[model samples]
Target: MVAGLLGAVGGGWLVTRMRLFPALLLLGLCQALVNLGYIWLVHSGPNVGVMAAVVSAEYFFSGLGSTAFVVLVTALCNVRYSATQFALLSALAAVGRVFLGPIAAWLVPQVGWSEFFVITALSALPGLLLVVALRGAIDRAERARVH
Candidate 1:
């Protein structure tokens, strides 16, 4: 919880200092890579230290990524209907988790922990790619917010 709060504050500050697209992409990659810590935890067995480190890293990065996501979504909204659009976009953001929960459950048994973590890491690529592709759109939205 402390780690996550720190991360959120850090992320908010970092995003203000950097370009949103690159910051978001970097944070997304960090979030994805952090999942690999679980692979180590699973293999090492009952070590509380490793577990604490992994959980802290995971929460920290998750909070950072969430901050970036909120900023991106807010930037994308128009002032006229910001409330409605933000609500809709926020709900859409949750679709992956809601839909993928069962898939993740099934996937673990089929692929084992390490491979599943790898795949989870790889799953971040598409979203990152989408950010790359939408660079122009994101810039335009940022400009709109500024003006």
Candidate 2:
């Protein structure tokens, strides 16, 4: 609940203040920030307070990132096939999330917790880079979103 609220607020702020691609890059960066919390947990071991805070932070950022992603997918969709495109994009995302879980499980054993989290953080970069690459499309989406 708290995370959802924070995420909505973050999303609202992003749409109002920044263009789509930049907002997406920012959202990805924020999403990546949560990995540091997990890294802290691995290094310091978990205290109840830190654990709670980290969990909330993770959820908040996840919510924000998810919202931004949904918006981006929606923006990218053709108006004639909006529903199908959104569903397809969302399904692709779900597949990625599902597969990543297993890959993470495999990776954790090889890398240890801290490195795993670092790798997790690094994973966010590609999305941000993609946003950079798609700046033109994003601007068009932003314009469409406005009017």
Candidate 3:
């Protein structure tokens, strides 16, 4: 947890030098570390009950985080598209949850704990790339907004 916090601070500093979209992408990559920690804790020789508790906590925190993200996304959307875009974003989040269980099941057994975490961390790379790719557009759009 200490290391994760430090990484977040460092990443945030580094990201500040980047344009908006890329910074958001790096934010996603940094956020993925939270999942890595949960995976580590679950696989760290804890008993089933303890593991379940940890898992529950993780999910609870995740839902909180998702709510925050959704709020932010909603805030970022144009007024004209607010309802439709927010609905779409919420739907995508639901789809992500649906796929998560299967993905975890498939990867956890095959790669074990350590490798599984590495892969989970790697999963954020595309979001980082998306931010990079969309940086200019994001900046322009944001700058043009009335807000």
Q: Estimate each model's TM-score.
A: 0.97, 0.90, 0.61
Whole-model lDDT per candidate? 0.93, 0.83, 0.61
* Candidate 2 colliding pairs: none
Ranking by lDDT: 1, 2, 3
- What does candidate 2's lDDT look like per residue over 1-147, in tens digits? 787788877887776677767778888898897888987776667588888888899888888888788888888888999999999999988887887898989999999998988898999888788789888988898789778
Candidate 2 lDDT at 5 equals: 85
Position 24, candidate 3: lDDT: 62
Report the number of the highest-TM-score candidate: 1
1 or 2, which is superior by lDDT? 1
User: What's the best-to-worst order under TM-score?
Assistant: 1, 2, 3
- Candidate 3 residues lying further than 4 Å off, grouped into runs, are 1-23, 39-43, 47-72
Candidate 3: count of backbone clashes, pairs at least 3 residues apart or interchain? 0
- Summarize candidate 3's per-residue lDDT along 47-87 as a digit string, tens digits: 77666655554454444334334434654677898888878
* Backbone clash count, each prediction separately: 0, 0, 0
Model 2 stretches astray by more than 4 angstroms? none
Error of 1 at 22 (Å): 0.9
